[model samples]
Target: MPSGSVALSARPEIIGGPPPGAATLEARDACAWFGDRLVLEGVDLVMPKGKVTALIGPSGCGKSTFLRLLNRMHELIPGAALDGEILLDGNDIYAVGTRAQQVRMRIGMVFQKPNPFPAMSIRENVLAGLKLARLKCDDKDTLVEQSLLRAGLWKEVRDRLDSPGGALSGGQQQRLCIARSLAVYPNVLLMDEPCSALDPTSTRRVEETIDELRGEVTVVIVTHNMQQAHRVSDLCAFFLAEENQPGFVVEQGDTLEMFSSPRDPRTLDYVEGRFG
Candidate 1:
């Protein structure tokens, strides 16, 4: 058996879902282009507000590109253009006068590598987003505690809040990055292979953190690890691209059904290791 097995939790993510009615992100006919080449096309996906949705596929399948579009990061690239609507609770994020910065704050992202400011202390790293977002936060200490606790790092690093973020182990730094994202109180969290670099032990801890975050925040993750997807995601979206075609979601459904009995033969092949 693989060492990356996730330990199951007994708790439901939360008591229903997001406050009153908020945050059901949807992609409507979303397409992305880099220069003249199209990477993703005609993609439509609904990410439930309080569930974890995993995007999985072979490399170069545009999973990461689609993930970046949620927060408008794809627009940063030179010659990159996106057409179609990415809606947050019925509001089109790409609509006129919608600030990308606010969109990013509402929908935060964590990269594959743990990138904490090397010179800043751990607590400072957690609080860094406030400065960039130019928002003042009262209850500073409480925010730090709450953020670290949510990331599952408070117990281990509680005594060393003043220590440099770079001083922690790779996994701990990743968690600190996660805490930084959570501190903003984003409605949706985007993780791009957040645990791909860690050792087995650290990976499991990060997976636990992801599981714990389900009810409190919306999570959209792009990962190549089928086992991890099955272990952590509530919904699984399988993306694929033919030799010269733009990538699109081939199938999406409950994680269990996707792994146990996928509708597409290609999905079954990829999950069963028959082909990528």
Candidate 2:
């Protein structure tokens, strides 16, 4: 929304204000802790209206934690507490008026492992979110069709919507999860290591889906695969942690610059494979 100022070079320009009707979500000096252990401290970032921002770091670096915080999922964990603000469309999600269910509806998530509801059919899984949201009225078929198509899974499973979601292949299942997230039509989609368990071919398909889904929803992914980050993200944020320390953001910039001309030496080392 701000002009003439660039945050991450690889990040697409914000253009004008909130993409002509897009919601504005931002995290300002946000901090999270589980009991006495801090995970993220004073983390500040923005999820541009309809762009993908990838969070990358080695294991235990809090990338997943950050993802959870975006949608208030962190608070669901026992003993977890949060401070500061997570603003959705300029309203703090932590505000009393903001309920957890409401926050999740606006910021849907996909997991590292495909956890399709085993009891639910493909069609049921896709509509699960809306069902929870209590959304009603016309065009149920149209919404399901568009959601599946948008997830790039329609042609493969169009005629078998009644089949169990677990009956799908690993890749199809992941796409099914994507469709599930899309059903709610969230303003942002958080994916945590979404392709980690898939094969190369499956990863490619999911990445392609991500590329296609851009401008339709804001996406934030946490991944250990640097190449995947480069291939799929518009912006990149690097995280790190040391002994006795919680993970913190080391550097964040455009994927191109972070991979090529990183401003931090640690980022350069990690990207160059000198360190994890």
Candidate 3:
């Protein structure tokens, strides 16, 4: 881990449970910097267990930066530094002696682009997280099936588990990536524009996967699409960064209320498509 890097850990039993449940995530007065420049500041938010929380903003608003901070990915960059605490289920993830790998296993990430190992078979890809985390699976077949079923991709690819993950369609590949994340039984999942690069159908399928993930995995997504945010998230936080200033939350509330009746004018402007 880097000088200022934070890590997390949990009880071993939480690693691969028969019924893995979500965890509440809270950021308190969180701030991030790259070397001498601050990129995000004073971020305070709570994402309840078993629900979706969407971070909405235009590019460069620190929504993605904030998402990375949740799983300790922000600390990977050289000279990166952060202040404040991130708590998972009431325990600070940055507590001394915690391990980065353990934090990642508990809080997985899905990126904008679907990235599956081109040469690895679908089944292998699903099981890859266990290998990386050095976790044991009593029955690999059952784990694979359950993970794929939770990700909503099992029925489509059950007959071809041996096929390369890269051979699946764009939507299927994204769902495969979701299954890969789920295979580790992460309590929280962070998505950075998971549907941006896909076509409408693929995007819709990905959204459905996210919906199905509720009650099993906590989700925090960074999205520029207001409609998509409205369609998927239960909670919404609008972020904004004025010129030469660090990004901060402009407004945040229940998804319906935030969209229909934002207390902040900036939020209304952005959501109404009048301005970013």
TM-score of 2: 0.90
Worst 10 residues of 1 by lDDT: 4-13
Ranking by lDDT: 3, 1, 2
Error of 3 at 22 (Å): 0.6
TM-score of each: 0.92, 0.90, 0.93
Off by over 4 Å in 1: 1-22
The residue pairs in collision within model 1 are none
1-276 in candidate 3: lDDT tens per residue?
222111222222324432467999999999999999999999999999989999998899899999999999999999999999999999888899978888888899999899998799999999999888888876788778777877778989999999999999988998899989988888999999999989998898788888877766899999989999999999999999999999999998999999999999999999999977
Choose the strongest candidate by lDDT: 3
Ranking by TM-score: 3, 1, 2
Displacement of the residue 195 alpha carbon in candidate 1, Å: 1.1
lDDT of 1 by residue, 1-276 (tens): 122221212111222212221267999999999999999999999999879999999998999999999999999999999999999989999999989988888888999999999999999999898778876665678778777877889999999999999999999999999999877777899999998998989999988988887766789998888999999999999999999999999999999999999999999999998877
The reply for model 3, stretches above 4 Å from the true place, is: 1-19
What are the Cα lDDT values of the candidates? 0.86, 0.81, 0.88
| Best model per TM-score | 3
lDDT of candidate model 2 versus the reference: 0.81
Residue 6, model 1: lDDT of: 19
